[model samples]
Target: MNCKQLQKIENYHEGKLQTEELNFVKKHLESCDECRRYLDELKSQALLLSRIKNFKPTLINPVAFRNEVLDQIQSKRNRYLVVRASRFVNSIIFILTQPITRYSFITAAIVIFGVFIFQQTIIVRKIESLEKRMGSNIVAKESGRPGRKNVDAFFKGRMEVQSDSDEAFRELLGNYRSLQIRYTVLLKMLKEKYPATYQEILKELEEAELLPENINI
Candidate 1:
């Protein structure tokens, strides 16, 4: 019959309490006069509230209220699905394109490599031919030198021939070195002048072994 028990008056009148709770409040109200009077007043107020008319126009429509709530929920769900589907499609496209992209890159690399090898082959062959021709020309010149051969002159001619061969070797070696240097310099220049040509020539030099393998920069 305490004031705390009176708090259940609303729930009891509305029939919202569990059976045991309702019985407890009812029993307390029966035993306590103050609690019984308080419960009566609460009942009277609830009955008056139920009979009161407070409805107004232009403020609420139940159909529109339900539709607005449903539309908002439906819109959120549709947007979520669209975002998820877009991400899925983008991922699938990327996966499908990965192998094709890799294969195209590999094909380009192979083509460039082949062209470089062919050019280097041509350059090396031309240089070797030039070296042989130059050697023959040098030998011919020495053989034509005025020597009337006596015992002393014969030995001297032999010495001259050796010297000529030595000169040919030196000259040819020097020309080879010079050509390699010039090729390097031209490659650098071409990189600034024509990048495409420089790339092709660089590939040739690599395959031809025209320069030391470690000679970068």
Candidate 2:
């Protein structure tokens, strides 16, 4: 309430007040609810700061550590779920340092490697079996086809082409389609930038039946 009382309160906050001054302020605060509230607020704030200053971090659940160690020991452990390791930096190292943990990790790794090698061996055997089956089937199919004619001068040293006209036409059509696409692209560019060249190539393609006569660009 008074200037002297307020000065004493400030001195109390600063902690530089004499014993006599402290005793006087304590007496004044007993009769004054406002100063008492003010001191309580200050004490609460100081208590909070003191708690912060002397804070002791809590440990993670021991069950979680045990579960994490078990996860690492298992061969089929999830690589993404590293929940406990992130909390404690040396958890993995601590787990690995123990003789049991070391043996478990090595055993798990060996089991994983063995399974991988077993899978690879199975795959290699399957591939070899497939290759053998394919080779036998190919030989059987090849032997079923017509045999080659005489190599003598019976037909003026000319033997018939093994591939028929239909096969030849299909092959020719496939090659022509690729050539047609390239020529089409070139014709488009020529049509815009060089009209005479475009007309010549277009005429050649149409006459060769590579493109339809009435086809739109």
Candidate 3:
């Protein structure tokens, strides 16, 4: 059959065609097996759809259904969070309660204390060595001078004679300035790290007139 005649089969089966067009498609289908098969397939599809349309769906409130799903999801999330929090707390408590943890903490503290003591000891030794060297130099230079009345006289004579040479005096001044810079830097670090000790040192320096009374650190 022609495409136009085949296309009218659906209209014929659905009773949408005029009486004359219906009769024409009916005659064409009888003569053409392809058109007859197409009409049968279309009728079967329509019948299946009609049966599906006849079914009545069970109704539900969409808002309530959506709220119920959301509530379930929120409840699950809350339970998960609670479980995770509980696990974290339990783990912390477990570690804190363990004998090994306590021992480790004590060991760390002891090690830190020992390190601090060792550092202080080294610094004290260095200071003492520097002082001894300076004293020995002054003593050796004054060995020829008899009747050195006291330590003050010896130091005064040494200081007076040491500046006789311009080059040597300049070198001494340079070393003194360098030492002063280093001391200032160290003092600044100590002020930040140990405020109490720094305060005591500052007070001593101010009393001795080594540091200005109005200086903060």
Best by lDDT: 3
lDDT of 3 by residue, 75-161 (tens): 999999999999999999999899999999999999999999998887655544433444344334334333334323432332333
Residues 3-24 of candidate 2: C-alpha lDDT, one tens digit per residue: 4576667679879888998898
Q: Write the per-residue lDDT of candidate 1 for residues 1-217, one digit (tens) a residue.
A: 5577666876787788998998898887788787788878888887777677453346468899999999999999999999999999999889758988779878989999999988777765554443334334433344544322322232223333434355454454355654445445545555765587567646654443333443344
Candidate with the larger TM-score of 1 and 3: 3
Error of 1 at 114 (Å): 0.9
Output the better candidate (1/2) by TM-score: 2
Please rank every candidate by lDDT, starting with the best.
Answer: 3, 1, 2
Question: In lDDT terms, how accurate is model 2?
Answer: 0.57
2 versus 3: better TM-score goes to: 3
Root-mean-square deviation (CA) per prediction = 18.4, 21.7, 10.1
Worst 10 residues of 1 by lDDT: 147-156
lDDT of 3 at 93: 96
- Weakest lDDT window of 10 consecutive positions for candidate 2: 148-157
- Find the candidate with the highest TM-score and give its number: 3
The list of candidate 3 runs beyond 4 A from truth reads 1-49, 53-59, 95-102, 116-175, 182-186, 200-208, 211-217
Candidate 3 structure lDDT: 0.63
TM-score of candidate 3 versus the correct structure, residues matched by position: 0.44
